[model samples]
Target chain A: MLTSATILSALLGGLLIGSAAGLLLLLSGRIAGVSGMAAAALRIADKGPPWSQAAAFTIGLPIGAAVVLAIVGRPEVTITSSVPLLVAGGLLVGFGTRLGNGCTSGHGVCGLARLSPRSLAATAAFMGAGIATVFVARHILGAG
Target chain B: MRHALPGLVVGTLFGAGLALSGMTNPARVLGFLDIGGRWDPTLAFVLAAALVPSALAYLLVRRMERPVMAEEFCIPQNRTVEARLLAGGALFGIGWGLVGLCPGPALAGLAFGVWQSWAFVAAMVAGMWLQRLYADLRDHRPVHFTG
Candidate 1:
């Protein structure tokens, strides 16, 4: 059920991310593409502000979520699967973001809007893989 | 204000829609994905609602001269379906299925301060780092996908 709190929170949350991405461009001349930022940070030439922006942007995510929880209370998180599986899943996602050249945000939102062919393929890949994994996890592994 | 500003505006509106539709709530998303343990079908409506805005945006953009940012209009190009592509897609899918979150909604969910989301984002960054390294080793130039 969609509550008023949920609606308000989402609106505010979206504003923050959009604002940050906008401010980055309006001020510094950069796209808030997470994969691009991560790539820049890992580069040997990376120094000063790029690293900071990447760190700050990455850090802001959790802080923002925390702020919401403080206001609306925590949601119950249940994981029936083992920790190893979860960690493995995380590692795979890391690799995928790299291979895909972007994650959901970079491709689904940023790339797609740009109408970048790469983003389209990447987004399709994102959805296709997600659907396949769900099918396998539910029917074969019985993980869900 | 011409380039990313509009994108930012569109993104914020999209984010708000997700939140209002209850798609941004991790628990609701988890329930939707669960399939067996109290399956929630509310996400269907969210998806349907989103189609309107998505279609409108596409129509608007199609009529525009190049986007306000770049030298030319952005268009996807890479079409070769290779091994790396398949592998990467599979991995991303597995993570999404397990966690019930993706980067966009995950970032939005960040407003809630979930430790798991932190972990997920951290892992996402690490993955990006590894990929950059691999790309650098494989090619002298940075991987620039035109498509």
Candidate 2:
């Protein structure tokens, strides 16, 4: 249940994330919102995204993680959620992120940073719902 | 190549950050959401810390004539908090609470070789496709994603 809050590591990691986001914004003039990128991945000409940068950024996420896994250690990813649950969750996440027009990265991080009201509203709604869902699952449903 | 290079570098840095911050760990994310239980404040720190640089970057955007690589900073102009936004956010939260993996972490989690990661990502993509199809039907046109 309760674990030690690694504040320093989170802070450092967040700074790196923020820097990366900032770099993207400055260099490529794009918000580093993963959901948006993934949702529109196959829609080659429908949208106005620069496909080259989007493709490279999408490809690099796993590469960076693999490097960390090799050099340091794998991030503790002991997921016990059933395949059914995972699928349901993924479907909801995918549909919802697209519907809302952003996810944690887009709304929670990038949106908040830019002081966008819509992002703020979306983030608040998600955070509130996320907390409520966890409570229901853990306390009521007896699920993880 | 220049365009691709910057994106690759940025994505790498972002992936490392997600891993190093323990965002890649579903447990850590769930723990943060475990407010009535054993709550963790690590996510808060990460969100707060992340805002600093991006906030500055946005401010800088105001002053710059144009971005280095792009013709213009490609930010969408959706200001209102519409019903779709709230409903979609709530739905996403439910899924996130169930799995503790969002898009960013899910993509990055591919490196961890977890079955859950694969299942989640595949289903997520399918869901996105479903949503796009639904949107197209609603508008009677293939909607251009401005996300």
Docking class for model 2 is: medium
lDDT tens digits by residue: candidate 1, A3-45? 5654454444444444444444443444455555444444522
The all-Cα superposition gives candidate 2 an RMSD in Å to the true structure of 2.5
Evaluate every candidate with DockQ and list the scores: 0.23, 0.66
Residue B21, model 2, lDDT: 83
Q: What is the lDDT of residue A140 in candidate 1?
A: 81
Candidate 2: list runs displaced more than 4 Å.
Answer: A1-5, B142-147
lDDT of 2 by residue, A64-113 (tens): 78878988786678687898999999999999998898899988889999
Candidate 2 chain A TM is: 0.90
Write the residue-wise lDDT of candidate 1 on B8-74 in tens digits: 3434443443444455554566556666456666554454333333334445555666444544433
List TM-scores of chain B, every candidate: 0.74, 0.93
lDDT of 2 by residue, B7-125 (tens): 89988988888887889988889888989988878889888999999999999999998888878888877799899999999999999999999999899899898878999999998
RMSD of each: 6.4, 2.5
